[model samples]
Target: MENKTNNYSYLRFAQEGKECIYDLFDAFLKKTIIEDRAIDFSKSMTVGDDGSIEFVTLEKDGAEVAFSELVGGDPSYKSVFELYLRRKACKAKDQLTARLALACAHLHWLWSLGMDCKTSCGMYGEAISVEEHWMDSLEDYNRESGLWHVNLSEAGVKQDLTLVFAIFHRFVTWPTRPQFKSVNQVKTALVEFVFKSKKNSGAPVRNGLLHLCDPDKYINWYSFESKTMFVTFHSEYLRGYKVSDYSELLAQDSLYYTRKYPKGMKLDPYQANRTEEKICYIFDRMEDNMPA
Candidate 1:
């Protein structure tokens, strides 16, 4: 933070091998002891053209919904899966609790990473509630003495996910082990939460790309046939943050939270480089896997 050297400490807790999208999916299939009263996730799920998940709901009419409907655009496998898991959680009572707990863990991640930055910018983003979603007091009601104009504030961009979690916790207290009644459930939820909560949109830079999972599927990047390499966050909100746009990234500590496992879980230069390589590889692979 103070060094202004782009320490990139956020990489310390990123998603890596065995924790990647594919790996996480495998684990979810193997684990997840909860009884799926709604949809049996054991059934193979496919990705939509827009990268949304083509999943079916077992509710009342058993209607179907795609990941794109809920998740913005060009959804990543990570975000796609998280959304799917959350939907499944809705089917059962226990999983719903676990998902909420995992949300709290995700909030902790946002808070912890910003603090790790230890920079003035980090402090600023952490302190300020970027998107404060609350009722406009005047919009509440009307009085005999005066007329009340009610206006519900929309959810604008927030600097950090911590702020979102703060408000959310107010209604559904932070997820706790005791409350969940199972450590395994909390642990699983934490994995999904951590995996999906990283800042995927910050790759070539920083901005609204926060809360992304894997950019390979979610993001769009330009390949250079003439000169230098260029990466871009394709989201309408994130594209605004240009390269080296420090202010916008005051809260976003890492391009993506891809971790180095079985090695003390430290965020270092090697891991940073590894993360870059993975992204590069994904884009490269896109050439072959991309639609015709």
Candidate 2:
């Protein structure tokens, strides 16, 4: 019965989650004051043939920054929304939910910023290559009647929620424009997609911090046992500093470990990973450094 209740709660959460996201977007649109100098940041952006948004960085004052950071760095909408969500989540003692909420807020903030911003429905591109372990051999013990059979871990299971979260964040925050979907539709789709992704994963199992090579291939390298997973993240502008750079930093810092994993297994998903928090913190810091 407890399991049933949790299932139902999540179902309801998904449904209402869409509404919550839509409401936030609506509020942002109504409340934000557009800056005259605000670049039509949505220009040149495409949602792609697939569902993924093609994020490209723009040059401002000789610095290149992605749309995510640009919208996030905006003083008027993005910063305020992030600050509010941080406080609200802290007050409720639900940081995970809070982070999710902030991600949604970021989407709304982006959407409100301009119409040129758009979203797509598929993957951006390929992932950086790395050495991956393959099961070269498997012992057959069924004939001996001493042990059961073994199987390679299933492929296509998305263990990382961060990429999903980040993608949804970008979708929701997409600026209102001629090509974009209605805010309500975007919100509903995000909630529905998240629920579907979770449901398809078979069970409510949480894997440790997951980063995507693409939406289909995810790498889970941060573990108490493995301690680190080497990966290369795609960047439009910079070749050296990729998403994996951030992951490497988190792995080195003992303070970032969740301490929720057993002695052997990876950390629990429910426990807060510092990587996501660090991303948000960096955004906040950037906002602070910008001239007022």
Q: What digit string (tens of lDDT, one per residue) describes model 2 on residues 120-208?
A: 11111001111111101112111111011112153221223233333333443546523324433333333323333323232111221
The regions of model 2 sitting more than 4 angstroms off are: 1-79, 86-209, 214-255, 261-292
lDDT on C-alpha atoms for all candidate structures: 0.28, 0.28
Alpha-carbon RMSD, candidate 1: 21.9
Candidate 2, which ten residues in sequence have the lowest lDDT sum?
Answer: 121-130
Q: What is the lDDT, from 0 to 100, of the residue 48 in candidate 2?
A: 29
Positional deviation of residue 15's Cα in model 1 after best superposition, in angstroms: 18
Model 1, span 39-133: residue lDDT tens:
22224334334332222232324554221122123324234334433442322135433333333232332232212121111222222222211
User: Hey, what RMSD does candidate 2 come out at?
Assistant: 22.6
Candidates in order, TM-scores: namely 0.19, 0.20
Backbone N/Cα/C clashes per model: 7, 20
